[model samples]
Target: MNVTLLMAITINGFVAGQDDDTEWVKDIDALYKMTAEAGVAIMGKRTYDECVKYNAFPYKGALNIVMTHDKTLLTKSTDDVIFTDATPQGALQLLEQKGFDHALVIGGGNINGSFLKAGLINEIILDIHPMVMAKGIHLFEGDFPYQQLELMSFTKINDDLLQVKYRVKNNYENS
Candidate 1:
């Protein structure tokens, strides 16, 4: 299974503000396109909560799973949405068992860090915007070991945005 980390972050590497505000992000269509292509997206509870707060819940055309311990927040989950308390590796294993060819970690710091720490992310696709927020949640929250990546491709998404794709180098394989 291919595990890709797909995210849009500020120039300073912040995904969102302290209040879970994403007013700075401008490309909803791009995100929807990625969601459509990935078919499966895993996000932290904060990401889900922010989407719901902004009336963007139930991302269509994909199975969205919210990785959270407090599953009680959701009274129930439908086919399009589900809650799980699985670790990063466990979540990927479950998805693979279900026959998903690709899984995208659409994040809010903690989830991204967990996957990177667990060495579950194979690639990273970042759409870097022009703005920067000094005080906000970072791209990855915890301290993870240094990761090596080889750039696969890069393109200008628009006049103000650039998208970069990289293949995460497996140290064990390379060594």
Candidate 2:
């Protein structure tokens, strides 16, 4: 299965403010479009909550999986959402069984790190916003072994936004 870790981060690499404020994020339409095209998307509980703040729920026509240990975090059921405590590996397995050849890993930070640490991510597309925060959540939360990437493509979304795509290199155990 193909998995892409897609996110937006500050120039200094912060995904959110120290207070967990995501207002600095811009160019959400592109993100939404990418999510829509993926057919399957997964994110951590916190990332899901942040997305709800902007009412980007349901992710129409896509299977939106919320990875969380606490079931109660999900207030109620939704048509296109599946709340699961599955590990990244287990979640990918489920997606594979469902015949989804590709999935997108949407995140705040920790979830991205988990997939990277597990060697499950194949590509990363970052929408880099031009800003820097001295203290804030990073693009990848926990400590992970260094992984290399090969730049695939990049484009300027606007005067302030630059989107870059990278293929994960030397990230798999068998590589």
Candidate 3:
């Protein structure tokens, strides 16, 4: 299955720094619209909780899978969300077995890093806002090893945002 990590970070690489009430609603609406186009959407448990707190429920028919360490959270019957303790590997394996063509990894810093560190992400679609926040959670935190990417495309979405697409470059010899 093809996996894409979708994220919106500021020019300073902070995801939550620019997040405010107004910006969050706009971001969630955009995210839901984009994820609805995909077959499946995957998110970390922390992100799921934040979504619930933010009241960003998607359409009733939309399918969502949340990765969590606690299985008890799955007991709540929700039409759109399924909880799984499946780490990155388990989640990917399940998705592969189910024959999902594409998966969108949407979230904050740690979740994005998990996918990147696991080397499971094939592509990235980053919406970079043209502002900087001096203090906030960054898109990647802690000590995760590095991977290189090749720029596939870049588009100016507006005066303040740039949409950049990148492909993970695994073969250094070709580079």
Candidate 4:
């Protein structure tokens, strides 16, 4: 299956910060709309829970896969949503089994870190917000091996947000 990482980071280079208001809701909502239109959505436990809380709606009719340690918490349903406690590797395995052509990796830090460390991500779609916070979680927790990216496209969405799409360079043998 083809893997893609979709995330939004603040211009200051933080994901989550001291204040909960980092325009993340708007960014995430935009991502959710895009992914939902694409027919599948995958996210970390924290992000999934946050979406559930904020949206006040279950991801019904859409494939909602949650990455977490507690697999038992996931409901059993194939028609709508399915949860798996798999890390990036496990999730990719499951997606492969299900014959998924593409998957979106949504996260704050840990999720992105796992994919980058494992060299599994194929593309990155980042929504850059134009505000800086003093402290917050970054997209990369620490300095991992550098991976080159080729800018595919970019669009200016309003004055405060920039949507950039990049393909991970030579990260995948067949890609």
TM-score of 1: 0.93
**Per-residue lDDT of candidate 1, residues 19-130 (tens digit):** 8778878788889888888899899998988888878887889998888888585557677787888888888887888889899999989999999888888999999999
Better of 1 and 2 by TM-score: 1
Q: All candidates' lDDT scores?
A: 0.87, 0.87, 0.73, 0.71
Better of 1 and 3 by TM-score: 1
Model 2 lDDT per residue over 28-137, tens place:
87788888899988999888887787787767768999989885855554657888888999999988987899999988699999999988899999999998889988
Stronger candidate by lDDT (2 vs 4) = 2
Off by over 4 Å in 1: 171-175
Among these predicted structures, which one has the highest TM-score?
A: 1
Clashing pairs in 4: none
Total clashing pairs in model 4: 0
lDDT of 3 by residue, 102-174 (tens): 8888866777888777778899888887777677767765555667889999988766668899998763443
Looking at model 1, residue 126 earns an lDDT score of: 92
User: Scored by Cα lDDT, where does model 2 land?
Assistant: 0.87
Q: Which stretches of candidate 3 lie over 4 Å from their true place?
A: 18-28, 58-61, 77-79, 171-175
| Poorest stretch of ten by lDDT in candidate 3 | 18-27
